[model samples]
Target: MAGEQKRFARFFFYLRNLREAALHTGARAEEAEDRGLELLHSAETEAELKKLEEADSDTLSYVKRGLNRIAFGAVNDAVKLVFDADNMTARDIMGMDLFNVSEIKISGKNVLEIKFFDRQKALEKLGELAPQLDGGGESKRLIESIYGRDGDSL
Candidate 1:
């Protein structure tokens, strides 16, 4: 009906207007951000500007570390998926030629050590193959010791 058509027209008109307004708002926000950066760069003293720059760099580094942690977590999950229990054996992963596995003494017991080769592929394989004798926490800690990082700053 004509009423429905008018309603739809009004809806689209409002949507378009909102979109335009959002675009303008975004532009203004960007301009304001640029001006802020300009003002920061135009600090009263060189030492003050250098301090601000250092703070910005520190923030960027923290962001990078957080991103890296997220990325590493994703990769670790993917590795767990790819290296399931059935894919590898708990004992003798690097049988004779891989040279990526070794025996290490841990708490008076001999345990297999995995070298972090290419995004921890070897470690992932070892984790999959590690015996679940201790409800899996032992194996998880083993892997974490090699790759775990503290991100207190983030």
Candidate 2:
């Protein structure tokens, strides 16, 4: 039926958007697709669109947290600690907050290499989301909380 087709079209639209959101928040390709499919399958009613919108907000928050961790978190000290294997124990390595790290490898000559998520890309994504977050709504409240009513600070 035409109605069913239209509904399915709308569902796919939301799914695509959610998947892009997940990717912008630093999810792997497969992970983003899975999240989108899960969210689409979970919402069976028009009213459930609200839940999808809430999920977008959650994704934005996740992106922001990742950006901050990469930009301001203790990467320098963490890398130093990692390189100083003699001073670091397994428990210390396990306890480290490496949320900003993307990859770790032992390279040629036993060189330890660590890769971090791209901070510039994260900032660019946040810039893209800024206009959406500035629009009046829950996103506006989030912006206000972070940057203040005058849009100063942070």
Candidate 3:
């Protein structure tokens, strides 16, 4: 009775904490809470909780990698190969990395069109994940160096 209540209280506490963390990591509120609940329900012991944490870390890393891939045009090689080939084949199309591609269209005249997921959006998300990559401090230093630290040189 009391023990079960205590366990549930602890569980809710950790679920709220995890939701806050997920929100900080850019998840929507509902999504954060839902995922937190799901993760908490999946874990029974401290060791299981640690394993869940590791799995979450791995998922975040995978998302960051995917964002980098989209932001940096990592799919360009495949796209270029497909474009440069004299004749398009199923194999060539199958080998292309189209994860970043949002849409494809072909007109009656055989003009192929490829639209990609927004690179700028991907970069912004990556920046949110890694704020140090923004280079704000470096930019400030460069500005101060040019303006004698007071902007009075102008």
Please give each candidate's TM-score. 0.16, 0.46, 0.42
| Model 1 poorest ten-residue lDDT run | 12-21
Task: Give the winner by TM-score.
Answer: 2
Best by lDDT: 2
Give per-residue CA lDDT, model 3, range 1-31, as digits (tens): 3333334334433333444434444457559
Per-model RMSD to reference: 24.1, 13.2, 14.9
lDDT of 2: 0.58
Q: Per-residue lDDT for 108 in model 1?
A: 40
lDDT of each: 0.35, 0.58, 0.57
Q: What is the per-residue lDDT of model 1 for residues 1-154, given as tens digits with 9 covering 90 to 100?
A: 3333333233222222222222222324336334333332332323443544455353433433333333232232223423552466545333222311122223344433333324355345434544432345666666667667432333
**CA shift at 91, candidate 3, in angstroms?**
1.0
